[model samples]
Target: MGGFGPLETAGPVLVWTVVLTFVFLECALIIGLFLPGDSMLITAGVVLASQVSGEVHVWALSVGTMIAAIAGNQVGYVIGQRTGHHLVARKNGKYINTRNLTRVAELLHRHGFMAVLVARWIPWVRTLCPAVAGAAGMDHRKYTIASSIGAIIWAPVLLLIGYYAGSFLENVSWLMPAVIGTLIVGLVLGTIVGVRQYRAEMARPAEDFDLDEAEQEPVADSPWRRA
Candidate 1:
């Protein structure tokens, strides 16, 4: 058995680096809108389970990914909090359309903390929701709690799926290609769905969303609202 030659040669260091970097960036930056962090996580899980690159502990990988995801969300939240205020104050700009911002605020307000948790499972939303929460003045403490919960659930679940798949295929080496092909198909379909959803959301009229001043008020006891 030759094993997974590419993964074997890449080694643990490279695997860890790639997974952590993609995970962090996918949560923290706008670039994450296009990055397939979930796929990477699943791939990492497969690599570890297959034992192609020495003994890579599943727990260690999960923990590292969880930390990176949580921290990345924090960074994105801060960026949104700071930039959102300025965008609102300015009223108009090429990138900061007040109408869109208002809609985002309304969405965040209506969903509250639940959005943070749900968004984690979503692709583009996972990267954008933290910033949206911050922009909407969601209590920071609540955001943190929700994001933490989401990250905890999201990271391990995807990793485990990949790990299990790899483990099952370890002995059936010939099936590796089929399994990978299936994953690719799934990813493509998922991306198409996510993009369509995003576009639909963006196309909705801003007037459809409305919020009262009281609802927008920042909570003093929690970092839930600051806008």
Candidate 2:
């Protein structure tokens, strides 16, 4: 899909504009990340490189993408803080998963910065991490700092890699279809795995069920012979 038709836009500036917009939207909106963020960044870079006049600048693309990414994550963090937990706990909410939230909360507690850093690289998890951090009662300032750094670093790096790859394959006739197909397959497999894990976790009893339900036995007195 990164071939001669739609990608062949009017000019470099216009192309980068669209790319930045998509990046921001994806980072902010829960459903937006699923859009072609990785592909667009790389494609934009590759397309710019191949232009005879080279009107599109790599630094511009990188900076614009980084801005969109950081801002998007910030918006997501605020939204999640404001209403995400209540929404998920609601009866009919579709976006929130209680099990995954709990697990990620535990991960955040255990791994802290590493969890946030690593989560930056993952797809769906990335969008949810900030919200999860907020909902899990983490300090807002810390979440903001970590998410801002993560978004800036993660988005540009991937875009650059894609840009180089796209440049390499600019002339190749067969590579585009193959990349799209692989992405689709990987997405499907990821969905299946996520669903299975969610289902399995939901089937387990609440961790505190036994503690909450167990009968209280009389305490044995210490043998100090006090009444």
- lDDT (10s digit) by residue, model 2, range 129-207: 7766654445566666777788778777776776666566656767754653464455456546655654554454433
lDDT of each: 0.68, 0.58
Query: Which ranges of candidate 2 are over 4 A from the true structure?
Result: 1-9, 53-56, 89-95, 170-227
Residue 125 lDDT in candidate 2:
67
Range of the 10 consecutive residues with the lowest summed lDDT in candidate 2:
207-216
Per-model root-mean-square deviation over C-alphas: 6.0, 10.5
Poorest 10 consecutive residues by lDDT, candidate 1: 87-96
Model 1: per-residue lDDT, tens digit, 64-141? 888999999999889877765433311232222445445555556667677678778877678767776765566788
Global CA lDDT of candidate 2, please?
A: 0.58
Clashes of each: 6, 1
Candidate No. with top TM-score? 1
